[model samples]
Target: MQSFRDEIENPIVQKEIIDLEKKIYSFRNGQIDDERFRSLRLARGIYGQRQEGVQMIRIKLPYGKVSSEQLKRITEVSDKYSTGRLHITTRQDIQIHYVSLDRTPELWADLAKDDITLREACGNTVRNITGSELAGVDVDEPFDITPYAHGLFQYLLRNPICQEMGRKFKISFSSSEKDSALSYLHDLGFIPKIVNGEKGFKIMLGGGLGSQPSHAELLSEFVPVNQIIPTAEGVIRVFDRHGERAKRLKARLKFLIKDLGRDEFLRLVDEEKKALPFHSYEIETAAFEGPITEPLLAVPSVTIDDVEAFEAWKKSNVIAQKQAGYVAIGIKVSLGDFYTDKARVLADLIKNYGANELRFSLRQNIVIRNIKEENLAFFYQELAKLDFVTLGYNTIGDVTACPGTDTCNLGIASSTGIATELERVLATEYPQYADNTGISIKISGCMNACGQHNMSEIGFQGMSINSGKLVAPALQVLLGGGILGDGKGRFSDKVIKIPSRRGPDALRYILNDFEANANGQSFLNYYDAKGEKYFYDFLLPLSDVTNLTEEDFVDWGNADNYVKAVGVGECAGVVIDLVATLLFEAKDKLTFSHEALQEGKWSDSIYLTYAGFVNGAKALLLAEGQKTNTHAGIIDLFDTVFVETNKIELSSSFKDLVYQINKKEPSEAFAKAYIQEGVAFFENIENYRAKDLANA
Candidate 1:
């Protein structure tokens, strides 16, 4: 049980927390690294978030699987140390946010006894290694890849060569044809296969999500079992050597893959592989560890009641297990947000009853693996306590919005609030359209597009305008973007720029249109029968006003971005977060010197400019979260950066900043140079750093 001191109200702790922040920042700035210093930083709750004072503590639940006891611990830690919510990320890892600056180390210690880890979850280090939850147990009859995934994890965890890369790299493992794990969306996607009777892997190189997204290119036809490490090493080497270190925004693997054609990228890998000494492995079964035997289980007795509902959930959400009498249950969580109490109770129930194996899903949900038929009823009842068992109906309100204003500092329009309100409204008003399956609507507060609104069946992104003298907030809508379980993946189109308020109605209008013209058929079948143009015309109609048109066009998802100086934060869209830290060392100087407020083209409207400043600052903080700039310094504080970023009073700043700079324009080299000069200015100081014109 947790002690009373763990609570925020505990005396003799708040000051300690304050002191801890100093130590953490000191250590981060390289002032200290002693064990005591490190321990103090950890103890103070100074975790390495994507930024300073922002803590992102990633808990390792082996193989994307968490035990109930472990889960309960997570709940406790979150409730005590954080905002009391846990985010089940795209990777099978659980991330907690709004974590206090000092309670971080204590949070780490709380889970220390249970074999969980928070090390390397953030920073310029290898993040949590993820794999298919059912690596060995899928009855689909493919090779088990648990050992391979685990082996890679062990080797890469703090391995001198991989601890730091050109950028963060994610590796995903899949055992079957099903892309359930969305392995192709990762930097290194490993698929298990046998070649000439020996187990091996088919490696796909250089895929990622972010400002620039790329589908991995198949590199190795058959990487021998022993050579997986070296091949991966080659991929890393190529990335580190050729990665865009100068331009932070364009520095991801997707751009690398784009720069290097598929064949050339593989050729570089092959060349790197040729020089490395290979270590072969003794062949064993290549999948995962066998299912946990009941003898090892601490499961309590469960009583069944609701058979029909359970069966229905099992039909669409649950999948077959390799182990008999066991099934994998998928809990359809909305965007993977879990509160602390909810986490703790669910963890308790899961640990005591489930197989001590909890799987996080890609669509932001939790799954209990190896659940017995006998326990379904009891588990259902328990889940209901934590709000785990809600039926999902796909509608305008069934929107998947990222943590817009809740935690992230870069958000413009509060994606979570909008999504919740929209989902609630849509669920209540349009039952027919809301209940439609095979449909998804996603929202991202800003153009950095963490929400991946670009891939939504219906998508919304935050945008703003100088509506007369007042700044007007709105959402731009994109239609038809989606992935397919049926192998017909198509990207959504930027059909209309819908306002934030009209977002739900616009979506409902489209779905209802789909409902009317669907001609009484299945989802995909209807889309197939009615081609893109037919559906486009039906949804958009003749005019946009009485016909329902949204606000402005403000999205360019994963298709190469422009020279983005500052992005919108998940919390608020700000442009000058670093100005205080950068412009004035002593914040007290603000009273004497009005330089920042006066000479800096910063608008006189304190309310509006301050809001933009907050948004821009948060966006910069989030950009810091990407591990691109870790020196606690600011870059791109110039007129070009601020004007494009909306830090200054530019009318079309958002659009102009997001406008794609043609790769081949005026020689791609010169265009890249201008961007590079702007990016490199803040850090290098003498050569390229430009004064902040907006707050000069």
Candidate 2:
């Protein structure tokens, strides 16, 4: 542990790891509150698991890019800190489970030695920034978006504005108009666009998936590359100032846009331009512009033992790169689970044979880029040694799943179990679909959509069915959802609920009908043509609970009877609304505002002051037993409960005082004055609390 501490070079990162260690010690000693400690650990990517004493650590990899050295480092860290198993998430992050809570600081320091991080990977902060796996090598892309994605990830990693918000924020970049990165389902999504030969992006905003899925609204058709980061600053400022705070489920940016029309949301975004740190922050793409590697002197000639298998692998897993004479290979990682042994082997294979870089796909697979076209056979043979060469890479056989009951606290069923069973059914019986890239099947243990199940062509959500004096594991069948490209898509329709044991049978029925009657149309088009009710009727028999046998009481991959037990989810850190805690937080934010002001970060200072106002107001509102849900609601309610009533007098309304953040430019004078206002507001609240307590 001391060796790891000595390896850290960045003073800020070193301080972060030290603070985490101290916090863990305080929490173990009962010096820190449980809810407060949960927030701290989650923001650092240390999450409590379903099991009592273990944690799940999510390793954030920007745009899913990993170097051979970094991959080897991750394997080493995983082997030392936790189990050797690595789980790839739908967001292109790698999660390792069953870790001791106390060793996280050392684990984080070890990761930092290779320039990998765990910050903001979980909790109610900006999660990992993702991009197209083929970003730098896609033939259809107007330009590489890798540098832009990387820049955003760097700029916001430990930024002051998003350290703690109401809920998690997600951002993505699609390499092309295909929207392979699923742009339509993120808080902010970017698709490359070229206007008059100038590179830009088409922005999508406020889209999300949970129990309720909403499509994103088109924010901008085209924004110049230099202006994108500043635009993002404005958008985040607005979200931070007005997003929800108390109601966890309703706290996402989508609900705010739904409450206020898109026009008003964009108007607010425009209003924050004056508060942005940079009017146009340009990203340097020179380093990512050219080819990363060249072919070796000679192509190795080899005889293939099974030419048919080789051809199938090529058709399904191999992709031609934009760089001629090079190709990218896809390795289908089943259920997003891989061991460190295979990881090390793949790391060596990529370093020795292919390009030294790899990108993890949103579907939980790995894409090795920059392999010479002539070396495809050689690379395939090398990957085969590690059992890493899996065909049907992103096809129907390649199912996407989350760590359902295996690790996640909110898991309701066995997503990994069902996903494995479905893949087996597809490979053994429906072999013809081995190359069918049109359909996608995804599963989530619950409706959280961690697996992006609600947006797949065919989807399943974990649920339970109630029978007389008994409960059985069930899946909510969904249909007709898929990406439509260019920031447009549809959510799946919940067709019916069926027993989990009949999951394979349900798939068979759907595929059998589609193959017989689809008439060569894609699954989405056929689903649209046939309608939800038609399929619902066809699969209605599976929904019958009266015919359930003893096996139906057990879930997939489980030997015991099914029990519906869901733990508290830490995906969004627990909300602590204690009046004292809120007041302390307000004062802490005021301190941060002063520090940012000294650093000449006027935008950061302004946002910090705004957060202070919100926290101070929410503290008083909670003292008065007022419901503090949204930031906007807090401001308005404070004006009603205190300002209007003369309990706390001010020159203007509370809304007017707080909303000045958008009206005034982020200058030194404005930041200093705003800090004064926040200080005055907090003092007034403190005095009122003291008087109220004394009078009582």
Candidate 3:
């Protein structure tokens, strides 16, 4: 760790890596609480896997953009610290599994050399900012949204307001009205629009996909690009202060929007305006506005053995770019899994033959941009050598799935196994759908929707079905979910549940029925016309358990009989309620407050000081076995249990003391005074607690 620290040149990042190393050491020595350590490691992007004593590190990539150099750097780090296999997530980040927790700081330091990061990639913070891979080159886009997406990600990566929220927050940017980024299913979604020749965006708020999927409400029809950051910050502040903390299931921003109507929720966001650090953040767009300047180099010559197959590949996998004479090629990664050796080869191919950059698509596929149109045959032959020139790019044959029971703690069934079999079924039985991009299939190990199963045209969620004394892996079939463009969409309805081995037959039945009766309608339109019960009646026969064979008891990709074992999920970091740990965290908050104050970030310092007060008061409340849920609840309860009861003396009511954050403007004078007050409050609480503990 010390050697890596010396190699890292950025002082701020070096300090962060060193701090993580220290925290890991303390946690290993049992000096930190289990829940506290879980939260800490998750914030740094080290996640616990289904198997013990190993981790899954999520490498956050803004808008899923990666250059050739960065790709090589990632491959190198994966080879050193983890398995050589990389898994692309739905949000366009790369995940490497089976990593040792002790080496995370070193791994992070190495990636930092290539300008990559793992900070705030997981836990209750704002996750990786996602957008369309076609942002700059899509034919239908009004303007490029790359710089704006990049701008927002930079502003919020380590913002104090979003570091510790009630639940994870997701944000997305779409290139155009096509909404390729799935704007309707994020906490905040932005769709680029040019109104009166001015650059602006239509914002969607409070949308999420889980067991209960919710469509985002339109927060604004148009806000200038300069105001997007401030608008997002305001919404995050409201969520941090008011979102549920005690109930894990009810902690997302969507639930908060449901509890408080959209009107009231927006009103709270408006109330946070005074405390915001900026009224509008102007995104620097000039860097993204440019034309291709590649020299006209000599094209390489190659021969294609299978002309028919090559033509089919060109028809399906090749995409037209907004830039003339250039095209983007899509690589349909099977189950979003790719090994390091092929990745290195692919990176070199793109660097030499095409643009040095690649963007991971939202569907867990790779899009290589800036390939000259004239060199199609040569590039095809090269890609065919890597076995990457598959016929389908983003069609029904390209399935999106999560690593269900394979590595996820919450997985009850094998999502990847069933997904693979289904993909094979589509390839062998329904070849016509290979280029049919209208329909989509997605699967998740469980109801958490990590695979985004709830928001696809056809979806499957992992589950288990019990018959007498035996249990088998099961899948809940769903229908009628798709993007409706411009921040509107529908969530799939649960249609039926069938054994995992029967998944391929279920897909065959659905597709066969659609082909016979749909009569040229889109999949979503046909599902709407037929209604839920119409398909349920036809597919219900597969749900029968009495006719089960012995093979039905064994799940997909497994040789033994199925056994259901679900572990605690850490997607939303665990709540830490230990009294001593809470008090210690309060002191840590003050240290952070002083750092922010010294850096001249007034709003950040104020919020950190405010959090310190709440944490200190909550520590005393928890010492008495009181329930502390929301920040507002903690303030009121602290006043009730401590101030009003005179158990702990204070200059004023706790609510009056802490509520000053919202009531007063975030000026440097106010921030300094707030830090001082927090210092005094901590000293009082620590002394009182020490006396109380001594007496007990």
lDDT of 2 at 21: 93
> What value does the lDDT take at residue 218 in candidate 2?
92
lDDT of 2: 0.90
| Model 1's TM-score against the true structure | 0.68
Candidate 2 residues lying further than 4 Å off, grouped into runs, are 1-3, 294-303, 644-646, 649-653
Could you tell me how far off, in angstroms, the CA of residue 500 lies in candidate 2 after the best superposition? 0.2
Q: Rate the local accuracy (lDDT) of all candidates.
A: 0.54, 0.90, 0.91
For model 1 the local lDDT of residue 479 reads: 63
lDDT of 1 by residue, 170-242 (tens): 7777766564455556687777767779777777666665544556666766777777877776676566445
Best by lDDT: 3
Tell me, what's the RMSD of every candidate? Answer: 14.5, 2.0, 1.5
Q: How do the predictions measure up, each by TM-score?
A: 0.68, 0.96, 0.98
lDDT of 3 by residue, 429-464 (tens): 998787888999999999999999998899999999
List the pairs of residues colliding in candidate 3.
none
Candidate order by TM-score, decreasing, is 3, 2, 1
Candidate with best TM-score? 3
- Full-model lDDT, candidate 3: 0.91
Residue 588's C-alpha lDDT in candidate 2? 84
Question: Model 1, 518: alpha-carbon shift in Å?
Answer: 3.5
